[model samples]
Target: MLCLRSRTQDAWLQRAIGATRDILVDHAHCERKAATQALMLLGRFPDVTALVEPLLDLAREELEHFELVLALLQRRGWTMESLAPSGYQAQLHALCRKAMPGKLVDLLLVAALIEARSCERFKLLAEHHPDAELRDAFGGLLAAEARHHAVFVRLAGRFDDAEAVRVRLDDLASAEVAILESMPPLSRIHA
Candidate 1:
């Protein structure tokens, strides 16, 4: 299961469905950000050979998801544009450790939590959203999001013991739940 401490409320799904265009656009931005985050990890830990191939593969897959979202938007005759961030990521990331291997572990765990959340939300959309197109699109994405969550958590374990990583992940997952509660729901993927 995903390490999330709370389930997204029905209210959030209603808001997302009400703003489908914005949600799709925000999802596109989220995919781009996920790919960037994977690359950023690679840059930050160039000497960590174990991370190279997996992170590269993740980044590639994220970009592919980004393209898929873009195509979905295009098919709807909608054009992509910038949207204000929901600020969820900044709040979650602010809790990361400032130091070395700890930083690496925290970063990986945070990414896992993010992907876990996305997978959860995508499942809701895939199952409950009224639009068949959106439902099918989200269903297509569900497995990859789950896989990414596993990848990040597994990579985090490479830097620390299982128990230590679990504790940190639990702490971070609690923080992530708090971050979501503190924010008003929006169409953005993390809002």
Candidate 2:
């Protein structure tokens, strides 16, 4: 199951659907950012042998997803472009502790939460989006997102004990609920 304490609001879904082009652009950016984040983690912890290969693989998959999203945008006669920040990720990352294991644990859990939320949103789009092709595309991404979520959670366990990770995950998930609740309805994922 997703390690989320709350669901994406229906109103946000409607906004996303209503602004499909904007959402598609935002999704492409998200995928690119996801790839960058994986590489960033690898850069941050090169000595952590366990993180190297998995993070490299994640970066590759995320880049593939970015390409896929870009193709989707091209097909719809829309090009990816910069958009304003929604602050969802910033808010989530701000909750992380500054220390070593605590920082690592929080970063992993935060990544997991983002993947969970993306999976949830993709599932919703697959089910409810009006365009059949869009639905199919979103459906295709669900598995990868879910897998990424699981990967991050598993990686977190490598940094800390199960009980500590679980408690921190719970706490972070609660904070995530508040972050999502406070966000305004926007076409961007995690908005």
Candidate 3:
């Protein structure tokens, strides 16, 4: 049997749940945006069938996750509200150099980093959400996001030279830190 945390921990959990709910709503929007971007990239990289298929699958899954989040919001009687766009994504996109293989590498690194961050956030939410249902939902999402991060990392390796990829990943990581630091307290997801 799963033992729940102590009362003190449960208090903390409630706060975390509220934050997680906010994140879920914002993440639904992010997933939709990502799916659209992936589809656009597929059109551009038609020659890479092997690379495109996994991304296609990822797009489908992200859409499904979006639907799930929408349903959850509906159940809670929460209408989706417009939130400020995250600087994290904008910063990532800015790092995407216009050059050939460089663009592809940058995209992959950005994707991986975003997914990894999402996974980390979800794990934190899962551990802290007061409600068992919300905890379970976040736990499942954390696992999926971890997988998505791995997939992007593997795909990046396939498409780009190792040295170039490493350099860009380092650059992107620095950009990510700067973007994250500059943002105001972004309620769990949206700034």
Candidate 4:
């Protein structure tokens, strides 16, 4: 089940529409970072053989998305900018526990939550954004993000007990919901 809270405020949409270039810049960097994160995980957990193939696939897809987003920005005459800090993601990481025992579970839960939230945001934009191209692009990404979310959770089970991971996933999801609600709304993607 999708677990992210919708961006209930109309203001967020208005912001996104009014500042397409800025938002696209952030979105592009987000895709780049997502790929990097996947690669980093594969590097960090070489012993966890189960993570290799899926993480590599994830990294490739995310990099592909980065390129697509970059092209979209270029078509609009927008150049990529230095990424602004993502407070929302930072808050999520702060919630992550160190790997003493639950490290793998926590990391996987965070990955799942991020992908789930991104999927929700894409669906929202696909349905509501006025720009046809963007709407279609976002719609196209839905399936991939859903797959990414599932991959992370499934990998988590391989790392630990499935039932325990499920419980932790639920708890982390609730924490994510709170973080989303409390953060100041921004025009950036996933904010």
| Highest lDDT scorer | 1
> Which has the better TM-score: candidate 3, or candidate 4?
4
lDDT of 3 by residue, 57-96 (tens): 9889888878877887787777687877766687778878
- Can you write out model 4's per-residue Cα lDDT over 101-134, one digit (the tens) per residue? 4787688778888889888777877898889999
lDDT of 1 at 55: 91
TM per prediction: 0.98, 0.98, 0.84, 0.93
Ranking by lDDT: 1, 2, 4, 3
Give RMSD (Å) of candidate 2 vs. truth.
0.8
lDDT of 2 by residue, 128-163 (tens): 999999999999999999999999999999999999
Instruction: Give the range where candidate 3 is weakest over 10 consecutive residues by summed lDDT.
Output: 1-10
Enumerate residue pairs that collide in model 2.
none
Better of 3 and 4 by lDDT: 4
In terms of TM-score, how similar is model 1 to the real structure?
A: 0.98
- Ten-residue stretch with the least lDDT total in model 4: 1-10
What are the root-mean-square deviations of the candidates from the true structure over C-alphas? 0.8, 0.8, 6.1, 1.6
**Worst 10-residue lDDT window, candidate 2:** 180-189
Candidate 3 stretches with Cα past 4 Å from truth are 1-21
Clashing pairs in 3: none
